[model samples]
Target chain A: MKVKLAKNYGFCFGVRRAIKLAESKPNGITLGPLIHNAKEIERLKENFNVVVNENIQEIPKDSEVIIRTHGIPKQDLELLKQKTKNITDATCPFVTKPQEICEKMSAEGYQIIIFGDEKHPEVKGVMSYCKNTPLVIEDLMALKNSKIQEKVALISQTTKNIESFLQIVDFLVRNCAECRVFNTICNATFDNQESARNLAKEVDIMIIVGGKNSSNTKQLYNISKEYCKDCYLIEDYLELRKSWFDGKKLCGVSAGASTPNWIIDKVVQDIEKL
Target chain B: MKVKLAKNYGFCFGVRRAIKLAESKPNGITLGPLIHNAKEIERLKENFNVVVNENIQEIPKDSEVIIRTHGIPKQDLELLKQKTKNITDATCPFVTKPQEICEKMSAEGYQIIIFGDEKHPEVKGVMSYCKNTPLVIEDLMALKNSKIQEKVALISQTTKNIESFLQIVDFLVRNCAECRVFNTICNATFDNQESARNLAKEVDIMIIVGGKNSSNTKQLYNISKEYCKDCYLIEDYLELRKSWFDGKKLCGVSAGASTPNWIIDKVVQDIEKL
Candidate 1:
């Protein structure tokens, strides 16, 4: 089988910066998983002695802490500050834009509507910035049941689909007296999805390499599955089956923002050998 | 023949208020046509001696001037103020909202996008309030060929259709970094269009009663024609032909914001006789 790779894939600017910041300081602890990739986190644990701690209270006093790229809630950050003065913030600039907008708009008396999964870490972080309780909707159906105020501001998760976000915006503008929209989806997500979609259209089988819990990876898998039927999402090369590649003439490979180049290279090499 | 009227039709609050204000001051020269309906303007001229003057410079010094409901340009308003202190501003509150938003958003360093006809008096009035030159687009195709800025504020004419205005909002929110949308479309336009559409769907023939130059009337006619094939737009009962009601058992009637109730009553009476 002829193997082809997407033009844009692997670690994005925010993920790379976070990884670099983590490596610079040894024996440090991250508030959460530094990035979505499990293999890279394991590598950092083994080489730099950086550990992931889910609970903020579990960390020892005066320990060096690094924030995750998705960011923590506003109150959590304040608590972390009281615990220790040494803190490294790895939150993405794109994600911070919505947080600031929410704080400002909410203070200006505009109701905030966040278009994303309420359980998602990024959405939880953004919601904490609002002065009033913000309405978080996953889709258009959720909005249909809710009563929106006269003035509302809308923001979306950084890794969400643009088409879906616009549908929510269209609904709000038609019903409300005033609507303010902030396009907070990052450029990396756009480029990665576009490249994966283009490559998937011309291939017989597609392989998406990323962590199972990664949001952008799932988005890529979903988009690729629409174009190519024989598609699989895996964390590493070991999950690939030789029989699946037997009848395929052309194979396409794509990865998410948190996916490291080494993992993608391993997957490509294993597919070639099959 | 059975004559049916729309549940919501005829003079809106703004038009009624303008007419009442004009009638209170007899012998006042209106800066422009007080409203879209020619018949109503003629009635005002004959009954109250209110004259329509299109040219601003031709008005004699210290003359009583009544502004049109759609409003004049910002510079024209300034000149009118200088020309005479005795002025009655009849500009609709719905139309004034966009003008205020344009001035505020423009001063805050945001580009303005007005979703309406460039030649329209309302749009022209709104554009003059913006500090920078604003872009006016009638449809989505016009926006496709133009380049939008990073930050944009969108406002629409009060009489525009809700669906078309929402489409422009969707497109701008998807492309721009920041978008502020003010839904300036009035409630009267929504009620009128909805009522006309509901009646047109069940009637055998539809009659849209309003002036040819009225924007809201044209919108009602377009929406009615979508559901009923035999639909006619007429200024008065005299324009209604007997052949239109030849085999039609039910006739639906709808009027624009500027249309007076007396004209609608005459049309209904004439339809019954046919």
Candidate 2:
């Protein structure tokens, strides 16, 4: 069996920068997982004594507080400022862009439309920047259910699919008299998904590596599944089955932005043995 | 021979208000023909001394200045303010709405889209209110060539056809990311077109009465011609040919908003004699 790797697989600039920041400060408490990959986060915890805590109250007063890659809400940032002087913001600049856009547009009295899953932490953080509650829609059809305002500005989360964002834009343009759109999908997410899609078509079996809870990893897995039927999303080499690769001639490997190089290399080495 | 009239025939609320305002002040020189009906304007000139002046510079200082129903630009209003102390603004409130929207939306950094003929007095007046040059497209196809902005606000001239306006709106909603649309079509135009459309199906010949230069009158004539082959647009009864009604079993008469009650009555009476 031949094992091929996607061009843009593994840790993105944002994730790498975040991990480096986390590693620089030993005994630091991250608000959440610094990066979505569990294995890399585990390595960080083992080597650097950095711990992930969902609640800020659990953090010790003297301990260094590191904001995660997804960034915290304005209210949380304010609380963090008052709680500790030792703070390292590992928040990705790509995620910070949409927050500023939402805040500026909302303050200008424009109704803000965000095209992203409301449950996602990045989307929640962006929405928190808006002074008023923005219309957060996951699907295009959901727009019909909301009361459309006369003046609107639209922005997307960093990891949102570009095609879906364009579809939403098309719908808004025809429905509203005036529409303003901002393409906020970061270069990392765009390149990763594009690379996975291109690689998926040339291979018989595809493997997507990252944390199961990671949204971007799930997106990569779904995109690969669109072109190749034998696509599996796994956290580690332990989840790999020998029987699935029995008849496959060419196998493709892709890792999410949060997934480290070590896990991807291990997965590829195991696929090569098949 | 049978003569029929559209349910909502002539002299709309705005036109009636303008005429009432014109009649209250005799010997008043209007900036333009008090309204778009030539015969009614002639009567105002002959009976009320309300002469139409193409240039405001011709008006005597301290003389009462009457602004037309299709309003003047901000610069002209200021010039008029400086020229005369006694001024009666006959600008229709419906026409004033779009101007205000253009001003406010442009001030808030939204690109304004006006759906109307660029050269038309009402559209020109509305366009003048925008701080930046607005995208004034006459048809849906014109929109395809223009660059669509993400944040937009759309308004229409009071007399634009609702169907064409909605088609333009449909295109905008699908093409723009965030669009803000305001339906600025006045009630008079809606009722007039609907009434004319209903009346045309039953008539053998259609007569659309108003000034030749009137945009709403041209729209009425166009709409009536679609349903009736023998539709004629006339400024007065002198332009009406008796031979056109020779074989017609039923005749329908509709007048534009600027057309007076007297012209419609005379046209209906002439058709009755056929």
Candidate 3:
């Protein structure tokens, strides 16, 4: 069995902690599929004996709960805390920073604005840190209509594009009288985009690594797709068809945050065999 | 009459509409500076202006309300409408469209991600359109952290930087599993930026026209400043110093969306006089 692992392959700090917490759980429900990888999620399901991230339709008093790597909205977390007897937190620390910044800004009487999807688990988790409802405006037109009194504060989710954040900040500078902004995009994401972009420039074919549902993995593919003509996003070695690699010379690989070292290694080895 | 008229004088579409509506109001309470230009604002105040953007404490219930050219937040508009018996809305139509798109997306369950600022009037206006609490994550880190579960929709403010917007969207396209984005940065804005960039290359001195407070005007300066050795943002003829024209054989003049034709003409006249 030949195999090569992605440089970024394996459980990231957050994912590893989440999986570890699940294993240590005496008894609890696993919030939403813990990670995107089906195999990993399946393994966790088998161990913790819990369901995916679903609303509590039925709950027994004092039932333990385990939060996933992607955190929950403030309301959901609060509601969960209120209803549950014990909660095991597994959200990433990097993910929590934006929320903290936003909350601090809101406390100081600044109109808090967040940049990202309003409904994303990460956005919700970040927003949860805020004291009040954040004004989530997604485009310049909405920005043209944003009603900040005197001062405004801005923040973003970690996985967001850096260029987008600067654009938004520039827009704010152009539109508003007074504004404050925080650049909280993660360093890892920057490395991924920069590396992917550089790799895309040199490679003929860019094979992105990660599950289909993984957002970060999709991002790597998208960045690579812009520069390279042939870029395919795949989950694992099993998904790679023999013919897809036909006549391919140089290939670049990238993965999502949740991917493990073993799977990345396996996919690379399989591709090497091809 | 020291009323030195600029060749590029009078209100641009946004300011014109805002001024006309405010003038139509024989009554009270101006929502914002009718225009960023102090002279124009002074004239409005002398006639029928009562400013209330970041400064006003309380507005009477029955006062006539006028919105400015830069656009106001949706919530503020709503509150004003409720407070005033007669309302005179004068927002520029060009600046209004992006807000509509953002609001619609927010209502539809898409993540409202703006490519612009959190405090900009345009962004604030757009923020108001969000059905739920929206976010304004700026930069790759913010977007990376955003990882919202639902779809993300992005739009740019009319006068934003094209390169910046695309970079952000590029990040968005990669990271987001599914996204719908609109290049809402206005046509005039693109033309202005393109024109300025192109002119910056050939001109010895690039004189940017519009108010210091004007966002687009500043962007024009930034763009021109890049290619040209001498690029100055001039508010009017009065701001033109003799030193700017000291031995300059050729000069280029460009105006912002809010800059009047008379201002550009005055600047040109000043350059000629030098």
Q: Please report the candidate that would top DockQ against the real structure.
A: 1
Error of 3 at A202 (Å): 2.1
Residue B183 deviation, candidate 3, in Å?
25
Model 2 has a DockQ score of 0.13
lDDT of 1 at B202: 99
For model 1, name the residue pairs that clash: none
| Candidate 1 lDDT, B88-176, residue by residue in tens | 99999899999999999999999999989888888889999999999999899998888899999999989998888888887887789
* lDDT comparison, 1 vs 3, better candidate: 1
The sequence of per-residue lDDT tens digits that candidate 1 reaches over residues A20-109 is 999987899999899999999999999999999999999999999999999889999999999999899999888889999999999999
Off by over 4 Å in 3: A1-10, A48-50, A137-150, B1-274
For candidate 1, give the lDDT.
Answer: 0.92
Tens-digit lDDT track for model 3 on A92-186?
77677776777787898777878776766777778777787788866556766877555677776666676666667666644543345565666
**Cα lDDT, model 3, residue B175:** 58
Fraction of true contacts retained by every candidate, in order, equals: 1.00, 0.19, 0.00
For candidate 1, the docking band is: high
Instruction: Quantify all predictions' global Cα lDDT against the true fold.
Output: 0.92, 0.86, 0.69
lDDT of 2 by residue, A48-75 (tens): 9998998987777767999999988899
Candidate 3 lDDT for residue A161: 70
- Which candidate should be chosen as best, given TM-score against the real structure? 1
TM-score of each: 0.93, 0.65, 0.54
